[model samples]
Target: MKTIRSRSDRWFDAVNNVLIAAVGLICLLPFLHVLAKSLSNQASVMGNKITFYPIGMHVEAFRFVFAHTRFFEALQVTLLVTVIGTVLSLTITILAAYPLSKPEFKGRKPILLLYVFSMLFYGGIIPGYILMKALGLLDTIWAMIVPLLVVPFNLFVCKTFFEGIPESIEESAKIDGATNFRILWSIVLPLSLPVIATLGIFYAVGYWNNYFHPLIYISSVDLKPLQLFLYETIANTEELLQEQPDSVRLSMAPEGFRAATVISSIVPILLVYPFLQRYFVTGMTLGSVKG
Candidate 1:
């Protein structure tokens, strides 16, 4: 059946669409400006002639970024952390959440309360650094991966989603002499793909964009992640540009190099997001609304 909309409804829809489009454009404009600056000629960039579009297009900025050895090293470190961290986090979260989702599980309430409490309160930065130091995780890649393995909010979200699963499905599996682990592995996980994908993206993005923990824990230049590398590049653009070969320095402006670094750091997450976006809303809504 087609529903008829009143004139006011039409006006409201028009206004809402216009407002949303304006907000999206507002957010997108800065990124476009950065992209333009990265591609524009040094003279065009220095003269403030570049806007949303490149005034004098060139790939020199990108070529310089790609040729930098530190850029690849940081990229490699970030990729390792993101991939390994997401997998480990999802495993730990699923294991913890599964037992908590079951009302019959022993000490569920206390354990859950602890998670919630920790979520609400945190030890300060110094305490966190001390803890990492004590654990011998300082200056190691594990320093970045271990500390964020189980986010309380993500735990609760997973637990709630698990609770929403119908009990009858598990009972049928049990009647067939399937073990709890078997049920979870063969049935529960397969059915929970949306939530998994949603949480995977969350974990991946967190690991990818993390800077503070790495800044404190990672003293070694070799272990610094992409975000930290990008920060240093932007903060010391003039020095970094001067260090570059004269050909590179002549080919790209400091602003162009900074813009290129920014773009390079964000591209991985941008590429990954669209693939998982279909599941993101569904998982978040179902996981959040159930309990």
Candidate 2:
């Protein structure tokens, strides 16, 4: 009977749903554990007593971070870098990718090869450091972003996406007397939102999480980004061993503060993620099939 068949289908769907939910929870459990550990008491954390839920719920860790002298300032620096760096990287990447996407463009192959070559073989860190030093980017915010602006992987993906667009559509736009720039701004971009949003999230997250560049290039305390500041606080365990007065060392649990910093770092990512969630899914399947 048709009714029996419908019931069977519903049961299959329910089973699949349960499987998916179980997998989702499995993947999420680690992050949840970290969050719980971060809010739990330092003593509990030190004793290896905390699990997926807070033990002896405490506010010291969050309080310690909030009271840090450079916390807010570093946060602002990181925000500025994320916003400005994402915009610049997006602009340069699109301009580069769009031209490369057009086969008719002379020497496109060579340019693309050059981009790909860098990915396979990179100049080692010493040379890169020398180049940055020569550029006078040391001790500057530009040091963090300028070096990593155009990622070759993202560039290739964008170029591939653009190439996947039907040439006939572009031809029609051209026939309508729309200039290439105009067409890009008015038409191509609107359709390319999926990839753009995905790339924006990539760039934003990259910029937000970058710390080593600042550590190496920036010596000025005021110029350091939030990640570097947090790293200095949490990752450098030697500080805890220093024979400093108890008054100087706050009672905040190091583990909890680390958690708070991680949480703080993830907030922007979380905020931007919802907007890009649709695009992220769409971009992954951008050209997987042609219809």
Best by lDDT: 1
Location of the lowest summed lDDT over 10 successive residues in candidate 2: 240-249
lDDT of each residue in 1-291, candidate 2, tens digit only: 445568888999999999999999998888888788778877788788877899888766666556644678898999999899999999999999999988899999899899989899988878888999899888888998997799998888788888888889889999999999998898889988878988887788789888778888888988889888877767764364244446535455667767766766666667767776776677676644432
Question: Tens digit of lDDT per residue, candidate 1, span 163-216?
Answer: 989999999999999999999999999988878888888898899989988888
Please identify model 2 stretches exceeding 4 Å from their true place: 1-23, 237-251, 287-291
RMSD of 1: 1.4
> In candidate 2, which residue pairs clash?
none
Q: Rate the local accuracy (lDDT) of all candidates.
A: 0.90, 0.81
The best candidate by TM-score is: 1
Error of 1 at 228 (Å): 0.4
TM-score of each: 0.96, 0.83
lDDT of 2 at 140: 82
